[model samples]
Target: MSNDHRRLGRELDLFDSDPLVGAGLPLWLPGGAAARHEVESYLYELERRAGYQHVYSPALGKRRMYEMSGHWHNFADDMFPPMRIGDDELVLRPSMCPHHALIFKARGRSYRDLPLRIAELGQMYRAERSGVLGGLSRVRSIALNDAHIFCPEDQASAEVAGVLRLMREAHEALGMGEVSYQLSLRGPGGKYGGDDASWVRSEELLRGALSKAKISYADARGEAAFYGPKIDVLVADPAGRSWAMSTIQIDYHQPERFNLEFAGADGRRHRPVMVHRSLAGSMERLFGHLIEVHAGAFPVWYSPVQLAVLPVGADQDDAASSFAADALAAGLRAESVHDGSIGARIRDAAGRKIPYIGMIGSREAPDGLVALRLRDGRQLDPMPQAEAIALIASIAAARSQELLP
Candidate 1:
């Protein structure tokens, strides 16, 4: 019960909430921003390697777009009110699938481009009630790690399974403890957009994917998104709390609403099934869970300050600065610490959860060597400064969970 994100988030200066800014909107501090940049860059690279075409869409869309996507009818309560422009209304998008649908229809597509995977690390706003908002866990603004895969209906199952694997891989790399799957379905009395037949088809496609992937999941009714049924990935944090950290939704309704079409093998236009997924959900939710589970000491690659160079005293400050520069040149996040006594500075860096502390004492400085100290209290033998920098850079580059590879 004590592993509250709000408790450690403030302690680590990751994010802050202010009354003037309104509830449910938290500001990421410098340290938090650095950590976030690392995480986002990793996600983008991972997506790129997997053949996803990254795209940028605007934060606001024409009000008619949501109406066309059916979010206006079924999900209006969760979305913010539209802004009035000159003879038009623009609304902050609550989801990216609608925009991606427009992208798919922007040009004629052939069967050669069966699976057009589009990804975006984008933002969405929610009109969350004041009483229900807390920390980064439940925020008004969400930066989603989202993608939409448009493919033929016959290939939907395979695409869903592939996304499930991607989600697991991402969760494991992020140090999320135990990842589980849930099949979220439409239940009675919900303002869902799709009809019974379409909902059944969506649920069946998702179920086929789970079976194909050999994944076991629990059924959660009324947890489905307004547009379709989804498979939700739950991460059980260290505190024994399970949170929904990722999602894969199979949607047939949006395509029908938007009339998305592609040229088929037989020279006929066909509808493309949309598969919406977010590997690690939103940045706020992911970091909130990470803060509580990792307890402020993140994995080496995503650690805000990967290496903090510590000089034994003022006499060794020059050596420390030079070593830090070497690490920075190697693309490792490094900073030279020279504000206080050597022991005090070491303690400060360690307390801040800096992964590796390169110590430049009198002996090491004279010989151009360094001593590496891990956050977990392991001390490596003195080695050449380049060797130490390589060790640290290698670990960070590989995104290894271990402090030392």
Candidate 2:
């Protein structure tokens, strides 16, 4: 296993999980939070463009709610111990499906609202074993990049296709390599929540969608949730290690279990099917994998500190600060460090895997330029301030993994 993430995370000042704050609960430092903010922003825009409306729910909920959704009974061992509050047992939510289902049930729906795509970067808590807790990859508290699509049975497959497209686009953008699919179906004679017909229909719907989407998959019997069948997207890291990072599940049971109803074309009530998706899976785990995949050298747009300004001498300190300010105004994350020698500053920034470094000195300051250094050891000698800022800004705007030529 790559233990480099821990060292890299510390060197980058990314995140920390203090025993005082409770194990498996990571505290995102400023640097880590900056990266997370960018991730969340990108996902919000992506999901919105795909017709997903965002929603919010409490982090903890009454146990009765989970009981109704069957999560309390099916996965109780994975949940935190309940706390009594005003005649109700409340626990931290291990998933967001129950809350979202309740939201769908809050008001009567029509066929027009058949495909309501609800999304949230919801916080969840799981009681992971202490021995298995390793940084952000395995955490008790996580922010799931989760969504639920409620549609009629006829529309479920089409909705799933849209989700598959989103998944492909996201993985490509993040540069995740080839993804394999696992179609998890119920085993023969296993006790499932829904009727046999519903289970068979749900399985066919998911399989049909995957086929329509032209995604080849392997069948995994007995790998499904109690409520339904699902497709798990597996991605391999740079080291050829695979992780189940994304999922799409077709669920007929939850809607029926909750008695969720919608009006059909004939003006009769019908149960809407629920398709669950988590494109990036847990944000924490995805972030952890990203940290390892990039080997701490995040892409320019995703880097917490996009540019670092170092002053070669005391005379250039003020100029360095001004240069950093200019870069920041240009929508670049830039900072000036004058406390150490230029060599030391550069080394520190490089250790943190900063993408670009700018050295200001008496020579460069007089010409109003900076000696630019790329992380890969390339140098641009004394480039004009405007040109440097423009280069960095345009590359960031492109979200390119490579440096501007």
Candidate 3:
């Protein structure tokens, strides 16, 4: 009955950590991986629709690259030690900004390419202390839903606003609980990069964007990234504790540091501004909150196992198999269980938090129908197998919160 994701994760077999594999790194089990893949696919589709060009970058970047991005200077303590191979010291990137910067610099750009949006679901590593590590919440290995937008200075506000809109949409679909926004500022005595005027302009730009979107946010000092100020998305868990899940930062420093520039309408070389953002931050940490908030019963859209098919004894095996095949073909996460009695199987499915249970029996099998048993103890009358599958598919496709129509 615990709401903790670590407990629920183990109970539902979503993920697990092993001593041999070392602390702070978790192994995503099949159920967990399946759900993750669905969410990742959704992000890719959403970003693509929003004009983001996805790119694949190597996991390791040279140490000089991090230094150029100011990560090695500011976050070196939290980053893993550089692996020395021959003359080059390669480090697992702590952030995707540098790699993305390299991508933006790979080609000449014009004002038309002003808001060049580049995205990646990339891997990063942190050298988190063992004591601070637990489950997926704080991990060494991370998969970040990261993106960078290189746009003209005038378009920075609009880009920030657009990121906020995208974040809201993603939060809604993912069932993130009670999300709040914060204007994280550059406070005193931190290792923040850039000049005071840059910080002030960045803050002002973010403020304009938030005001334009008519979104309310609280101001928090000293939480800004080393490079610039950010607008953070915080989600409250079931226990009423707040965790920062996503962020959008405006960086003028990186372009200067990397010497990133584009040709303007006047054919003048101008430094393009960089917008750093993630709609959903680390996949592992996001799911930690998700599992806790939902108590292992995710929304139908991303539920690890949406339908559990149980045939009434050996008589309905063929009918159940056929239904399952149809469900799979429709891109549904479905499973058929027949290793036990009907009652036991139903209970098993219920325990796993399966949203829909299709019970095929002697009477329903001949007609190619199924009786639906919902996780909430509702029973639906027998209906055509295709109709039931379609209904389930629609609910998932819509990312509906309801388990029943």
lDDT winner: 3
**Model 3, runs deviating above 4 Å:** none
User: How many clashing residue pairs, candidate 2?
Assistant: 0
Q: Clash number for every model?
A: 0, 0, 0
Backbone clash pairs for candidate 1 read: none
TM-scores for all candidates: the values are: 0.97, 0.95, 0.98
Identify the superior model by TM-score, candidate 1 or candidate 3.
3
Models ranked on lDDT: 3, 1, 2
lDDT digits (tens) for residues 144-214 of candidate 3: 99999999989999999889889989988998878889999978889988888988889999999999999
By lDDT, the better pick of 2 and 3 is 3
User: Candidates' lDDT values, in order?
Assistant: 0.89, 0.87, 0.92
Off by over 4 Å in 2: 1-3, 188-191, 236-241
* lDDT of candidate model 2 versus the reference: 0.87
Per-residue lDDT tens digits for candidate 1, residues 366-395, read: 999999998999999999988887887788
